[model samples]
Target: MENASPPSILIVGLDRYGMRACVRLGLEITVVCGGRSWDDGQVAVSPEVRVLLVDDHTNPEAVLMALDRAGLTDRAFDAVYTTDENALVMVGILARHLGLPAVPPEVAVRFRDKAVQKREIRAAGLPTAGVRVVDDVHDVTGITELGFERAVLKPIAGAATRRTSVVTSVAELRACSAAYRAEGTAQRTFVLEEFINGEEWFADGVLFDGELLFCSLSRYGDPCLTAVDTARPLHYRLFDPVTEAWAYDRALPLVTAALEALGHRDGTFHMELFHDPATGALTFGECGARRGGGLTQELVHTKFNVDLAECAILVALGRRPQLDIKLRPEAVGGSHLLAGPGLLYDCPSATDVLALPGVEFVRMEWPVGGRTPQGGGTAQRVGQFMVVADSGERLQERFTAVWDWFDARVKVVPDGLKTRELRELQHVLRPEARFGDALWQ
Candidate 1:
């Protein structure tokens, strides 16, 4: 075993974090990716790693052709995996092709395909909101059949809430869908789901062999569908197991059950659920069969000493994480300052942000002369920072102070509304989160 070559993997798409994990594990990595992902994520591949550039990593045919060209069809891969959400189905197919250790291709599609996921969850008798597929995202003539006054519309397999929106009226939906089509999203499949009003929270952890290895819960500041398009900074905080037992008691079962329903095993999971304080019910939003996005790895590591990226790779290679989490007494949280539209300037420096109380890390892309797209999603961030505190109360206070610390220094032009607030107000001002095209930036 000492002289054995490191476990080899065939990756469908190259993610910066995934690549880093592969290096740490000393795996022989072969990645099939499209051209734009290289520059988009600023991913740097080492010479030791094999890179196979294809026209589309998400396309099974293109990936197969790339493999055939590289003469890797018969290659004995230890596993087939992908951290990129877009290429998950393709990875599943490749996993089955190589008879590698990973979820079946059909099960893998459940993580990305909302319709199939919801159906499976429903069949499992889990509480899920009603969903109807919109064969054409641009047309919603049969909206009445959905039997809901308000609904959430998003791509079938989309991530980061790109082009996701809320529709309350037919006119508004038509206009929004028209806008989506006009922006070249006509070919994408979308779905409409009955909107569940409640405080939205998410759980992330590793599950192995149908057993929950570890779990962490966190509550979101606003309905992501509405907050992501506004000036409010999207934020959330991890619930301390000792301090916030209520969240753990309610969320743990749901996360595990839902992951099981989707047939997910031996991997890190990111599941979003809605907690109805009024009714004491949890509704499934969605789940991803990978590590949570953003600085989650850092946040989890800072508080619990768990490396989710490392765990993800280990699980893919059919190995146990054997996770030993040394939970710190302190709590961890993160805030993302998002833009609306127009130009952004005078963003705060990481050094200045680091000076703030409890601030542990900062990652921002908002430069002085950068421009933001119209429909600003999660990706449209001025930047984000992580904070740690001894308790949840102190964490909340620091979360607010971080906002005030940044707002005073940053400035935006053309429309000050784009990124001016730099703080969360929806929770305080509007207890009930509502979404419509009017709120869409």
Candidate 2:
């Protein structure tokens, strides 16, 4: 349907990359966002585009009313899509009502609920940890009967590993459950799964029309649950196809099957998994129904020369994406620079990080004085950056060099800062700054 006016698509949530990619693809777009989400300015939405805010984007009637209010109710829409998990079901609902191209609502629900997602994986004869769901508002002691010595605990919806934990005893389970309940928030439901002793890895893929088009696997520096609390920064290195061909051969099938098991026919998927170092077996962890967050799609480009953002928009518009994994010339890796379980007082500028050799990209996650909470889990970060190298050894060195460089300038106060330090910690938190020194470092 090539025409003077671009084919319009309705996005149910804010996704910066998807919006820009749509512009690149020459598509007309309308966006509907929940009032809280729209106002949060997370997307930093542009006023030039058509956007509608409603009390609830999940309510198709409200969305229609917003469209009516904006005089866009009768506009031709080619697809309904969203990168926000909270909006997937809404997008699916709108897609079904409008007969537009998108993943089915049932499939969307499967991704939203971890219990259903794991059940679907198990049903497909895939290996995933055995899980039991318990409400945080009740006595979670009953899960002890499952007889698993070690278990994993997380919100039923996988809330970015905010409170995810590995429990070795019932006491720990009760403590985590109590913490979640005490929060008095929507994440009162939790899942307990048998913990698998294996290396954690991430799988990113683009699937369209039930056919897998592109997939990439990367090895995490440590188990996700453990790394959130450690001072060590979380890192991941992409599997080089030349030396790690087995990773592709093994994980590609699992990713494809997992998507198929959940009836996720179209769009991109970001999945977590565990791989046994000894046996090479894979355990499905969790999957998200959109592109991986935080430069993942861009990292995909650095490793494979493929743009997942463009592919997602292509399928969203009911168009074919030229999906191909073209090998790059060097090793690629990414890191989330950890700053605190306390106050993050300072960090080097983006330019400071980019000045380091082999640093391809960097973004400071926290501004000066943005505090990271005690036990913030994986959400703790000062920034994220990517680096490239001609060899794997060089890549490791680059990562080490970046960390070493940051250690010199970045500042965090594990113990509460003094009144003056709270006012300014660059002097106190710096590496060379001394407690009783007469001059500031």
Tens digits of per-residue lDDT, candidate 1, 16-129, equal 667788888889999998877765554567786899998888898898899899998888888887777777777777777778877777887899889899999999999988
lDDT values for all models: 0.80, 0.79
How far in Å is the alpha carbon of 396 misplaced in model 2? 2.1
Q: Which stretches of candidate 2 lie over 4 Å from their true place?
A: 1-3, 34-48, 54-65, 141-146, 341-344, 373-375, 412-441
Task: Tell me how far the alpha carbon of residue 15 in candidate 1 is from the true structure, in angstroms, after superposition.
Answer: 2.9
C-alpha TM-scores of all predictions: 0.87, 0.89
- lDDT by residue for model 2 (124-199), tens: 9999988888766246866655457788777787555776778887788777767766766576777888888899
Model 1 lDDT at residue 91: 76
Q: Please report the candidate that would top TM-score against the real structure.
A: 2
Candidate 1 runs further than 4 Å off = 1-3, 46-48, 142-146, 343-346, 366-370, 411-441
Candidate 2 least-lDDT 10 residues:
428-437
